[model samples]
Target chain A: MAPKSKEKPKAPTPQPPPAIEDLFASLHRNIDKSDYEKAVKDADQVLSIAPNDEDAIRCKVVALIKDDKIDDALSVIQSSRNLPIDLGFQKAYCLYRQNKLEEASACLRGRERDPETLLLEAQILYRQGNAAACADVYQKLQKSGIETAEVNLVASLVSAGKSSQVQKALEAW
Target chain B: FPPAFQSIPRNPIVLDLAYNCITFPDIENRMKKTRKGLISRFWG
Candidate 1:
C-alpha cells in the first residue's frame, strides 16, 4: 500500500473582529450610570479583543476606582501597556484614597500638564495640609484656560474651612 | 496642555480627551455615592 498521504493541518478558525466602538460606548453608558459591574464587563470584553486598548484599560481602571476597588485599580494601571495619561491621574486618585497624600502628589507631579492631574494635585495638597499650595495650584490651573467641575471642586477644597479663602474662591468662581 | 491638546481645536477635539475631561467630575460624583459622608471633609 502506498504510504498514507500526508495529512493537511487544519487552518485556524478566524474570529470576528472586536466590536471596539460598541463596547466602548456600552462601557461609557455603564460608567455614566455608575453601573461599574457592566462597565468592567464591557471593558474586559474590549481588553479580551485587544489587550493593548488603552481606553478600555483606562475604563476598567475608572470602573474599579468608582467601585472602591482601589488596589485593583492601581494594579491595573500599573500593568496597562502604553499607559494613558489618565491612568497616572487614576493612580494618584487611588493613592489619595489610601491617604498617601505625598505619594499621590509625587505621582501627579510626574505627569505633564494634564488638567485632571493638576486638579488632583490641588486636592492632594489640601489633603496634605497645605491649602495655600492647593489654592496656588488651582489658580495656576485656572490661568491655564482649562475649566471643569473637578477644577472647581479642587478649588473648593483649597478653600474649605477658611472663610476668607472660601469667599475669594467663590468670587473667582 | 501637551502638543496633543494644543494642536486640536476645541470644537474638533476627539472623544477620548473629552471623555477624560469628564472622568474627574464623574469621580467626584462617584465618590459622593460610594463614600458618602467622608466626601464631606474634602468637599466642605
Candidate 2:
C-alpha cells in the first residue's frame, strides 16, 4: 500500500476587521490614558471606515493637539465640515500656541465666560501685555471656585504693576 | 509675581487648566445616539 500523502496544512482563517465600536473604545481609552499617539492612530483607523465620523475627527484632532502637533490639528479642524461638536476652544488653543493671539481671541468670541475660554483669554491677555484684564479674568475664575487661579491672579497683578493687590492676592493664595 | 513665578511664562499655567478642563467628547456617549435619517420629499 502506498503511504498516505501528508495532509496539507490548512490556511489560517483571516481575522475579521475590528468593529467600529471596539476601535472607538480603544481610542477613548488611549485618550484617557494620555497615550495620544496611539489615540491618533486609532482615530485614523475609525475615520477610514466612516470618513465623516465626527467623533473620530474630534478625537484625532484633540489627540494631535495633545501630542503637540498643533498645526496638523488645526488643519484637520479647518478641513472638516459640519462637525456636530464645536471645536472652537481647541482651535483657539492651537492659535495661541502658534502665537497668533488675535486670531485665538477671535475664535473664542461669544464663549468668553466659559472657564476654559476664560483661561485661554487670560493667557492671551497676559501675552499681549493686558495684565490688568488678565487679572480680572483670573479673579473671575477664582470666584468660580478655581483655586489655582489665585496664583495666576497674583502673577497678573504683578505684571499689571499692582504691587499692593499682588501682596493681597499672594497672601490669600 | 514672586521671584519664581516671574521667570515662568503663561504657557505652563494655562497648559494645566486646558488639560484639566477641556475633555475630549466621549466616544460611547456620542455613539449611543441613533443616526438621524435622511428627509425625503413626498409628491402628492
Candidate 3:
C-alpha cells in the first residue's frame, strides 16, 4: 500500500463571481442609506462587470448627482448613448442646475407633456425670465391633473406680474 | 428634488417660488472648522 502522503489540500475552487443582482442590491442599499460615495463605488463595480448596464449607469449618475458631483454625472451622461432608458429628464435637470437654461429647454423638446418634464421646463422658463412661458407650461401641467403644478402656476403668474389675476386663474383652473 | 437645491419662496412660502436657488458652501469657514476638528481629534 502506498504510504499515505500528506496531500496538498485542493485549492479552493475560485468562488464564483458575485451575481449582478447581488451587486445591484448592495448598490441600492447604499443609496437607500444615503451613502452615496459607497453607492458610487458599488455602481462602478457593476459597470465594470457589465459596461452597458442601463440600471447601473442610472444608479451611478444618480449617486453622483446626490453626491453633488454634477460635472462627473454630466460627463457620464454625455459619454453614454443608445441607453436602454431615457435619461433626458436627468440630463435636463443637470443642465438646469448648471444654469444652462437653453440647453435644458432643448432636452425637453419632445418630452414637454411629461409631468416632471413640464415642471422642469417651467422652471427653466422661469429662470430664463420668460415668466409668461413658465406660467403657460404650469397651466398645462395643472390641466393634466398635476396638483403640485397649482402652486408653481400661481408663483409663475405672480412672477409674470399677474398677481392680481391669481384668484381669477385659480377659479378658472 | 435634489437636497442641495432649495426653492426660494416669496413671503408666505408658496408664491413667487424660485426653483433651484443653488447655494455654495462657505469653503473658507468650512476649511477652518475642518482644521480645528482635525487638530482637536489628534491633540485633544
DockQ of each: 0.03, 0.19, 0.06
Ranking by lDDT: 2, 3, 1
Tens digits of lDDT, candidate 2, A92-150 = 88898899999999998887477888888988898888989988888777757765777
Q: Name the candidate, 2 or 3, with the larger lDDT value.
A: 2
Q: Which ranges of candidate 1 are over 4 A from the true structure? A: A1-22, A81-86, A142-169, B1-44
lDDT string, candidate 3, A1-173, tens digits:
98899865755765687657667767766877989899888879878889987777887887787788989989888888566667777788889889998998898798747667777877888889888998888777666776556887787788888889889889888
Q: Is the docking of candidate 1 incorrect, acceptable, medium or high quality?
A: incorrect
Question: For every model in order, what is the iRMS?
Answer: 14.1, 3.3, 12.9
Question: TM-scores for all candidates?
Answer: 0.58, 0.75, 0.69
**Highest-TM-score candidate:** 2
* Poorest stretch of ten by lDDT in candidate 2 chain A: A6-15
Query: Which candidate comes out best when scored by lDDT?
Result: 2
Taking every candidate in turn, the Cα RMSD to the unseen true structure, in Å, is 19.4, 11.6, 15.0
- Candidate 1 per-residue lDDT, tens place, A1-173, comes to 99999865655665676457666666767878999988989889988988886667777887887787889888897887355445667777788888898887787775786666776776666667676676666666665565454344444453554435555554575
- Identify the superior model by TM-score, candidate 1 or candidate 2: 2
> How much native contact recovery, as a fraction, does model 3 achieve?
0.12
Worst ten-residue run, lDDT, model 3 chain B?
Answer: B22-31
DockQ of 2: 0.19
